[model samples]
Target: MPDLRFQSQPPAHTEIPRPKRAEGQWSLGYTEPLNKNEQSKKDDDALNVRDRILYTYSKRGFASIDPADLRGRFRWMGLYTQRAPGFDGGKTAMLEEEELDDEYFMLRVRSDGRLLSHEAVRALGTIGVDFARDTADVTDRENIQYHWIRIEDVPEIWERLDAAGLSSLEACGDSPRPFLGSPVAGVAKDEIIDGTPALEEIFDRFIGDPAFSNFPRKFKTALTGHPSHDVSPETNDVSFVGTVHPEHGPGFDCWVGGGLSTNPRLAEKMGVWIPLDEVADVWSAVASVFRDYGYRRLRSRARLKFLVADWGIEKFREVVEKEYLGRELVSCDSPPSPTGHRDHIGVHEQKDGKFYVGVAPVAGRVSGSLLVELADTIEEYGVAGARLTPYQKIVLVGVDADRVEDLVTRLDEIGLSARPSQWRRNTMACTGIEFCKLAIVDTKERARDLVTELEKRFPDLDTPITVNVNGCPNACARTQIADIGLKGQLVMHEGEQVEGFQVHLGGATGLQANFGRKLRAHKVTSAGLDDYITAVVGNYLVDRQDAESFATWVARAEEELLRGEKALTPS
Candidate 1:
C-alpha cells in the first residue's frame, strides 16, 4: 500500500538561498521548491480536490488545474455569478482572499456588452487590491487585468468579479489569447464590415478547445477593418485584415509572423487574399498547420515565425493547404488600393447625427473612480458606449452632437482628453521593472517623462513621432514597430552600472512595416537621456526633406552620425 501519512513539517533542505553576486553584476532570484512532505500537507489542507490539484500544480510551476476541479472549487462558494445579458452563460467571479495565491488572479469578463463598473474597482481596491499599480494591464483585446493576487483571496474575488460581470476563461498560459478586433468596428466611418461578429465567432470556437488550451506556445489573432492598422494585425502571430479585392469581393488580407520580444519581427504576408465567407475555414486551416508543425520542445523558438523560418514559406503554405483543405489550395486575387490611415480621435461625425469623442488616457492608467466617472458621463450623455483603442486610449461613441463640448469638458475634468497633438497621439510603453519581474527599467513613467521634456524643447515640432519603450528585450511595448524604440539595458554610472537604454529608430506600422534600426545607447540618468532625444528629433526635423517623416529621416541617417549628434547635445 502507498504511504498515506502526511508529515507535520516540511522536509529539511527544501529552501535554497541565492548565490552572492559581485557588486557590479545584476542578479535575479528564483523560488525554492517544496519537499514531498510539505506538498502532501498542502494537498490535505486544500478545500477540495480541485484546490488540491491547484496547490500541487502551482508548487510545480505549471498552474494547471483541471477545469472540472476549477468549477467544483467554486460551486459551493456561490462564486459563479449569473451571466450578463446576451453572454454565453460562462461562470464569472471575484477572488476571495484565500483563492488568490498566484501573482495574479485570472478573471473572465463578460465579452458581450458588459464593461467593468467603478464600484467594482473600488471594492477590489478597498480589499487591498491594486490592479493599476500591481501590473494591471489591458490585453490587446478589451479585457482589463489585476495581477499579483494572493491565493486565499481567489474565491471571494471571483464572487465579486462575477457580480461585476467578469468571468474566468483561459486567460493565460498556452491557450489562444482573447481574439482582438477593431474597438470601433461598428462605429468607424470607413469600416467596410465590422469584424466583431467574426472575432466573437472565432473566440467562441477556440476559447475552451482542448487542443488550443494546451498548445506549445501562446497564440494571438486580430481582425481590423479600419485602414489605420490601429489593431496592428501585422504584429500578431495570425491576422485577418479587412480589405477589398479588386475583382473578387470583400475579405481579409491574411498575414503571419509578427511578434515582439528579444528578437522582434514584423509578420510577412502569407496569402494574397481570403474572402470574408471563408475566413473561419482559412483560420482553422492555418491553426492546424501551426498545431502540427510548430516547434513544441523549445519554448523560446516556439512562435509561428520560427516554424516559417525552419520550413520555407512555400513549404509552410504546402503544409497548411494539405492540412486545411486536404488538397491543393489556390491563391486568391490581389487586394484593392490601400486607403489612408484614420484614427478616430477628436470629434468625428458618425454616419448617424451622433459623434464619437476619442479620449487619450496617458499610459492607460484608469482608477476605479475614473472608470465610474466615465460610465456616468456616458449614461448622462445618452451615448451608445465606450471603445478602447490599441494605443491605450478610449473613445466615447455616439454622443449627442449638441452635447459634444460639454462632454469634452467633462472628460478633460476627469483627465481624459480628446485633443491629439503630434507627441501625445501615438506614444506607448510597457510596464517596465516597476512591476514586471523581467523588466530592466521603468518604461511607462520614463516614456511619459521623455515625451514631456521633448515637447518643452521642440514646441513647434508638428510631426507625429511614435516612441515605444519596453522595460526589457521582451519588447512588450512593440518597440520594434515604432518610429523611435527604446529597450532597457544596464549602463555604467559613476563606477556602478544602473538601468539605461539602447535606442532604435525608423520603425513604422501599416503598409510601411519596417523594423527600427539601433541608433545609440544612453544612460538613463536624471541629467542626460532627455537631451539626447531632443537632439535626435531636432536634427531629424531640421535635416529631413519637407514631406519626409521622422521615421523616414532616421532610416536614412548613419548610425555613427546619429550617435555622435545625440552625445553632443547637453541636458
Candidate 2:
C-alpha cells in the first residue's frame, strides 16, 4: 500500500450543511471561522505529515516543527504537548496552547481491543524507561499513555513500537479512535461469539486509511461478544453488542450515536442485527454517514450523537441504509441488560478450563517498571496474554486453574490487586491538571487520595458505588455515567477563587443508562470534597431500602442530603 501522501483523495461526500434547526451551538454558530478552527487545517489532509516529522522537524528538534502541525495536526499521530510544569490549575483557561505547551509531550498508543503480548509489553516499557522519563499510565481507553516524551525521541519510540507490532497512528484527533473490545472475548464461557476477527478486520481496513481519516470530530466504537458488556458499548459513537437472535443464533445488535461529555446521550439501538462476517462493512457504512452528513460547522456539535439526536433513530437508520450501506439490515430486538460484572475483576473460569485473573492499580497509575514487572510475572505464570479494560484494569488470560491462587498473590505483591477494596476497584479518573493542557483541576492524584480516604471511612459498606472524575468538560473518564461523578472546575471559595468541583449524582449506564443529575449552582472546593462525599454517602448508608443501589437512592434522595448541607459549606 502506498503512503497517504502518495495516495489519491478519498471518495467525495456531500458537503456538510449547517443545521437549520437547534444545532448551531458554539461550534457551528460562526459563518467564516474567525480563528481558523481545526476544520480549515483538516481540509488539507492532516495525515500528510509522515516525512516532515521523521525527516525534517524531528532531526531539527521541536523548534523546527511547523506551528500548524505542532498544535493541531500532531493529534493525528497521537501526540499532545503536555501542560508545562509550574502552570497552576487557576491558569488553565487563561493561557493559550502555545503558552502552555511543555517541551515534553504526551503520547497515547492506541490499544484496539487491549491485547498485549509479552514482547509488546516489554518493548513499550523499555521505551518508557529509555525515553519517556519512565512515565506510563493505563488509560480508560485501554491505551498505554506516556508523559514527559521529548519530541526528538518520538521516532525512536515509533521504531520500538513497530518492532512490537504496534503504532500510535490515528489514536487521537478527528479520526476513529481505538475501539473498545471485551478483554475476555474468546475466553468468557458465556460469550455469544468471538468479536476478535471482526475487530481485526475493522482495524486493518480503516485505521490509517486516509479515506476514513477525516471526520467532523473524533469517532469512537465498541464491540463485545460477552454477556457482561465489559466493553461499555452504550457510550460509544457506534457499538456492536453481542446478542443471540431467536432464529439467527449468535451475532450482534447494532447501536449508534452514543457519547459522553458536555452533552451526554445514550446510544439508541438501530433495530438491526449484524452478523460477524458483515460487521466491518456495517461499521464502515455507519462511519460513512457521519462523514457525509454529520455537522462539521461546529466542533462542539460535530459528534455523531448530535446528528443521531436530530435525525432520530429511524431517520438515521434510513440514511445509513439508503445513502451508505446500499443494503437493508436485519431488524432485531435490542440486546438484554448487561450483567452486573462489567468490570470483570477477580478470577473467573474460562471456557478453555483455564482461568483469567483481572486486577487493578490505583487509578491506573502504573509506572513503566510496573509494566515490565507485570509482563514478567504473567510470563512466569505461563499466562498466554493480557488485555486492558475500559474500567482501567488488566486481565491476565489463559492461566491454569491451579495457578490462580499463586498468580493472584503475586499480583497483589506488585500493587496490582486482584481482590482490591471497593474504593480501589471502583474509582477511575483522567489525566487532569498534572499533564493535560485542557484540564482545569487535578484528577489522578486527587482520585487516588479519595479512594484511600473512602476505604478507611467506609470499610464495612457493602453496596458497590462507582466514582469517576474528569479533569474538564470532555468527560474522558466517563464522569456522566458514574454513581458519583466529580467534574473539575474553578469555583469561588470563601470569597476567593480556587480549584473546586461540581457534582453529578446517580449517573449510570447499561439497562437504564442515564446521565447523573446535578445540584444547580452548587460547587464544592476541592479541599472540602472528601468531607462532602463522606457525609452524603453516610446519609445513604443510614437510610435506604434493602439492596438499593446508589443510583436508586440518589434518584429519590432530597436535595439537602445529596448536597451534604450539614457537612459542607457550598461555594
Candidate 3:
C-alpha cells in the first residue's frame, strides 16, 4: 500500500579512508565533520554527564567511571581529572591523555566576572575547604578552581554549589564558557554602561541550550563598559568592548575571533555599534555563525579565530548580519586607545565615593582557608561586594573610606596584600605540570621563586615588565601576550637535558596589543630563568628611552640582549 518513489542507492565509492579530496582541494565531503570528538558530541549531548554523575559516577568509585565520559563528557560538568602523580615531564607526549589521568579531579566554578555576594563567597570558600582539599585559585577567566576532587563527592559538591547559587556546568569543554566582564562591572565610577544585563541574559537564555552545546571548540567571551579594558578584550572569541557611536550615545563594539593558544590572533572589530538592548542578540548571532559554519575537520583549526581568519572580518560580519541577525548594526568608529590600568591592582574610588581595594595573590595561588578569611574580612568591613579580576587579583568593592587602612592591614596579614611588589604584580603563571597533564614544566612554585629572585636581584629595576609562565605550549597563562612569555619544555642546557622554557618576547594587549615575538634557537634552562630575565631586564633599564614601556624597549632591543647569551648556562 506504500507509494514508493524511485530512489536508487548510489554505488559506493572505492576511495580509501582519506578525506574526499585530491591533495589540497576541499570537497563537500571533505568539509564534513570528521573528528572523533565531533562524532562523540553528536552521539551524546555532553550535558547528559550531569545525570550520569548524579545517578552513576557519584555512587560508583573512580574505577567504575566510563572511559569516554571520564575524558570527554566530564568537562561539560567542570571536572578534569588532574595529571596523575609520578609522571615525569618526558612522558608528557609519550602517554595517552587517559594514561595521565589521576585519581583526583580539578573542579572549576563559574562566576562570569559578576559581583558575588559575601554569602556566596563564603559558601565557595567552604566548598574549597571541605571538598577540594583546601585548594582554591582565582583563574584569569574569573573561575574559582579546586583540586583533589573525587568522583564520589561530585554530587555533594553540586549540592553545596547549588545552595550557594553557583554551578560548574558549561564551565569547561566545547561549549559557551563563563562570560568574562569587568570585575568592577556595576560599581566602577568611570564605566559608561554596565554589561551585566547582557551577560545575564545570555547565560539565562542560551549558555546551556543544546543549540550551542556542540561547537567545534570552546567559546570565550568578554564584555565590559569600563574604559580600563580590564577584561582583556584582545584575547577572547567574542568580545563586546564599550564604545559610542557619534549619533547614538554609548554602547559596545563587537570584536570576534580573538584567542591565545598555539595560533595566536587578536580579535578584529565588526565596525558596528550595538545598543545595550541588542547586545545579547548580536552575541547569539555571532555564536550561531560559528556553530553552523566553523571548521570541524581538524581540532588544531577548530577555534573561531581560524574561521574569522579564513573569511576575513567583512565576510564574517556579512554572514552574521545576513543569515543570522535579520537587521543592520549601527556603524561605529575605531576603538579608542586604552588609557586606564589593565590589572586594576590598587585602591581606587568607586562612583559612590567608596573605595575598592585590589589585593594581589602571589601568581593567583590562594588557600581555601584564606578565602574563608577574606569573606570574613568583607563581612566584617560591611563591604558592598567582592569580585575576581582577569589578572588573577581580588577586589573588595565598597570598602568604607574610613575602614580602608584597616582593611589593607588585615588583607596583608592574610597574605592577599593590597600593595604587592613589582615582581609579584606583573607575573602570571598557569597550572603547570604539578596538576595539568599538558604541562611539561613547573609554573606556580617556579614563578613564586622567580619573584623572590627578581626582587632580590633587581628591586630597584622599575620598568613594568610582565612575566607569564606556562607549563607547556598551551599558553593558558596568556604567555604569548606577556613582556616575557615562557613556554615550558625539556631542553639540553650545557650538554645535559633539563626542564626549561622557550622564550617569547615583547607581547602586550590594549594600546600596543600583539603576541610576543619569538627568538629562534633561544631556550633557557629552568635554573637559568632568573639569570636570563635579570640580564635582559637589566639591559633594558640602562638602554631604554626615558619613558619606554618594557614591551616597547624589547621591540627595539638586539637579539643578543634578548637571548641573555652571556648570562645563560650554555648548552
Tell me the lDDT of candidate 2: 0.84
* Root mean square deviation (Cα) for candidate 2: 4.2
Full ranking by lDDT: 3, 2, 1
Model 2, TM vs. native: 0.93
Give candidate 3's error at residue 146 in angstroms: 0.9
Which lDDT tens digits does candidate 2 get at residues 1-571? 1122212323323333565663323223432322355445445677877668888877999899887888878888989999999988778888888999987889998778856888888887888888888888888888889999888888899999988888898888889898889999899988888999999999999988877886778999999998878877878999998888889988998999999889888998986788999999889888877765666666788899998988789887876666566667888888788534478889999998999999988888888888889889878888988898899999888999899999999999989999988888999999999999999999999999999999899887687889998888889998888889999999997789888888998888876577898999998888898899998998887767788888888899989989898543333
Q: State each model's CA lDDT, in order.
A: 0.58, 0.84, 0.84
- Model 1 weakest 10-residue run by lDDT: 22-31
In terms of lDDT, model 1 sits at 0.58
lDDT of 1 at 438: 50
Model 1 alpha-carbon miss at residue 195, Å: 1.1
Better of 1 and 3 by lDDT: 3
Q: Write the per-residue lDDT of candidate 1 for residues 187-305, one digit (tens) a residue.
A: 76777666666666676676555444433356777777666666777678888877666666567777777787876777767655665666766676666556544555446766777
RMSD of each: 12.6, 4.2, 5.9
The list of candidate 2 runs beyond 4 A from truth reads: 1-35, 38-43, 339-341, 566-571
TM-scores vs. true structure, each candidate:
0.76, 0.93, 0.93
